[model samples]
Target: MSHTSTMISEDIEAYLKEHEQKDLLRFITCGSVDDGKSTLIGRLLHDSKMIYEDQLAAITQASKTSGTTGDAVDLALLVDGLQSEREQGITIDVAYRFFSTDKRKFIIADTPGHEQYTRNMATGASTASLAVLLIDARYGVQTQTRRHSFIADLLGIQHLVVAINKMDLVDYSQERYDEIVAEYQVIADKLGARDIRFVPLSALKGDNVVNRSEAMDWYEGPAMLELLETVEITHDQNRRDLRLPVQYVNRPNLDFRGYCGTLAAGVMSPGQRVRALPSGKVSTVARLVTWDGDLEVAYPGQAITVTLEDEIDISRGDWLVAEDDEVPLANGFEADIVWMHETALEPDKLYDLKLATRDVAGKVKAIDYQVDVNTLEQRHADHLDLNAIARCQLELTAPVPVDDYRTSPGTGSFIIIDRLTNITVGAGMIHRPLDSELPYEFREHDSKANVVWNRASVTQAMREHLKGHSGKCVWFTGLSGSGKSSLANALEVELNRRGYHTMLLDGDNIRHGLCKDLGMGEADRAENIRRVGEVARLFAEAGIIVITAFISPFRADRDAARELFNDGDFIEVHVDTPLDICEQRDPKGLYHKAREGKIRDFTGINSPYEVPKAAEVTVNTEFMNQQEVINLLLKAL
Candidate 1:
């Protein structure tokens, strides 16, 4: 190592202490085929004096027979250790190397530059904070180069170093270098990386690899090693939200019990209250135990066992977070999936999903779209093949705490394993959770029944054009007596007076006819809304404005209803009348009967009413009259 000093021979403990204090950086090298990824890494190690003489001698001997370079010792042989890799002269797997300078320690992931091994590249980029994208000076840019760059950005690599290698072949032409930089700048702009630096270097000739190049006088930027040594990476960790996914429960004896995990993000200390996910159990940290000793404070990436003041139920696959943090409990989410298996992804087939330390069974419910990496276009795809990338909706068997990948990657990324084969088939980064879990009846049945959606020749657009207006679903939801029915009635009448077609589906009227068999239980209410939503969808398809008024108590049912319509077609109106006012204005005398213990599961009395979190329009009947609510609804429409 370049940091080797006389203290190593005189005082070993002092040397070890000094070496442990240096900052560590993890980075990856990726690009198109034969782009000098391995050569650049070997050159860095060779020039930095980090290689041993015996290993160097072995490579020198091997270079005479297997080296790509003629006569000269091939530096790329350092990382290409596999027999297949040496014989083929191409990287087939991820190669790792370690080196250090005076300022910082570094670990380099030398990734393959082939389209077939895109999954290997993704594996390397997942843990990398920076990417060294090598573009051959002669080729400007290539398809694999764009693909690797997109994957690097997608994996949340904040810093990018665009290494324009083999400048010697291009005669160190500043014009050629500038052109490649310009082309890559467009990609960097699309990535929106926090930091991007470009350097023109010849990895074989050692030009600008460790020292300034006399051949490329026009390029005045720092050399590749200097940039690596000085680049800022301390801000990359997510320190605002504490996350510790329990990997193991240490119970060696009856007197000791600790939760073992590497702190994924944020800070933790003794006495800090922690909440266990999926159980909502809270406890305070009593100790941060490690093999050496106890730590006063625990930072991200530290491996330690945490003992709690209160013994609550905690096991593997549960997350311990700060009590006040708001990580979402998700049973369904949308993610960008990189499929790596030969068998095409079966949307209905279940797979083992491992996120952090949590493992659960899940399945892909839908494939929203697949990406064309070269042009970055989204195309509709029904199934994903090997090395395919797509955005998919996944349904989990149980809820788990999750964060967006941009927020905390440790808890936001996951892998899909084949249940029978026990092989990893896919990787995913969560974009966001779905609004709520679909009711069991709303999900696809597992009976293997033959079903298909039939298409019609008469399109909705044709019907809408004939009516001179677009169809819409104006859904009104609130407590029973909160004027949802009255407002829905007024809006339909006004729309009809203006010569627009309208249909009103009132709750009482529907129960008397369409939902007469259903009761007021939770399951029956959800089914009732599901039936109404389908009928309203049919009316809207006929070019008639559909209006609905119901005390849709569950947010999940409301969200499911909204999913049936296209964007901007479903407008949710929340009636924000107070409970006191609703009880006083109870038109059906249901609130009075509920207070006298005569009614069961009456909303706003015995049953809970979940307020909408992001309703489109909100009206308060206590403050606003029916006409005002109707006018607002019309304006929104």
Candidate 2:
């Protein structure tokens, strides 16, 4: 092996030995552009003698081409290694760097400062125990600075270090440092930052960075390195509450089945009794096994495979908790979400919400408000756009275990994924479960003989009778004025007349009531289809045929809606009408409005429409009248 690889292996071994003796501290650095976050970390590593000779040589060569004259080695170059980041002089993705002092080993998450990469910052801060927020001594606290601080607080980062960086630029004036510290004091108080410390330093000049600077003799504060080494980080973890979220069940042989996962919180010892959530099965810990051998105990941050004395049916996405502490279970919850990706968050749609290892299919019940990061004010919103932070309520199809972020950060956070594309679109922190106090409702129903059949139940039966038909949804999708809505209405009429219970869910009609509060946006459009899918499922359960007509232009979104149904239950009927023919029809004057730019995000006018590749039925409106389209659909049924 190469010398560097050998050294890295030795370092990892030493780290493992040290970690067994004491707790580990993980922290993150966050602030605005040019706030010296990267410089501060580089200074910490350089002064600690963590930089190798080759690394130093590379930095020196890079400095000659990229560094400002007479500057202290352009320390930010040490961590910003990406080609794009180096050329743009900005941090992008979360860069993880590890180093150790005699007192404690440290893992630092150096996060980006750009406004567009707020999601990256949140991702890094989510696992951080402490947050070091840098502020420019000359510029004071800018909007991005406050915004990063707020996000750190929202993610449950308790300890905060306010580094008044670039002191040399501001002439090392104690008054200027004091002014910035005072401004942050108000913010720290509002964010509930438990332990807030202020220190004056110049990351670029290395003043009060790793050592005390003679230039700032007037300021009496611990040096950055000294503070990091001495800070009490043991209390930053949730060790008191035992939570082990099972990521996988390892069944290597027929006789043995072990639950494998990283300890999210607390400690687990061999022979300790634990309870699995939702299932409520109690078992005693039989053994804690690592790759090397068996361990007597395991704690948070340690990944291990655990065996139970009883042969219970354990699987991934299950949680193991202390028997005395109540297991988290709720069908509805309130969460603070940071919207990521280009798509907006729709209030009326269903999304795949993943918390720890568990995936819960949920719908957005309501969007309470969105926060203005610059002002820290909450503004009521119907939908949240990209890069927005909002408080919202969600209702899941089934109960999932969760804790309030203030109580347990690991068990309280989640991410939302697009069902069809599986792209992570949002991150969320649980504020509270909405139904914690109510009794658990079982899926039991009264006898059907005494009750009047609902539209949902009738549709559900029809879906089952058709086998592939009973649980699937028939989505009538096409351009507006292409006879989509008319064909759906006629199909429902024919089915009802033939003694089959049927319901026609028109997109515009539902929006007039059930989805009345939503609007038109990429995010809203996806969400609208999600809500309609759920309602159609309810109808299908009742043994009736449910037909839906909507101008769902995106193929990915339509597929996402189709996934909610069982096989053969989802039917995509494409009304193939040319744009010119649609305009000629101009049934509602929508085509004229779209042509004149009076409407935004119009499918054929402003936005690109995706044709379905595997549509179940394609009706040519130009060749066939409304009756012919209805007859084609009826024959298929």
Using lDDT as the measure, the top candidate is 1
| Candidate 1 lDDT by residue in tens digits, 1-637 | 6655898899999988988999999999999889999999999999999989998999999999889989888999999999999999999999999998889999999999988888899999999999999999999889987898899988889999999999999999999999998998887878957999999999999999988899998998999999999999988999999999999999999889999999999999999999999799999999999999999999999999999988799999998999999888888888999988889998979999999999999999887778887777877676899878998989899988878898899989999999999999999999998744333223364447755455543568757866879888999999999999888888988999999999999999999999999999999999999999999999999988999999999999999999999999999999999999999988999999999989899998899999999999999999997888788887899
TM-score of each: 0.70, 0.66
lDDT of 2 at 560: 82
Tell me the TM-score of model 1: 0.70
lDDT of 1 at 102: 83
Weakest 10 consecutive residues of candidate 2 by summed lDDT:
453-462
Clashes of 2: 23
Error of 2 at 491 (Å): 47
lDDT of 2: 0.84
Q: What's the count of clashing pairs in each model shown?
A: 0, 23
Cα lDDT of model 1 overall? 0.91
Model 2, 76-165: lDDT tens digits are 888888878778888998898888765777889999999888888999998888999999999998998889989999998888999999
Which candidate has the highest TM-score of all? Answer: 1
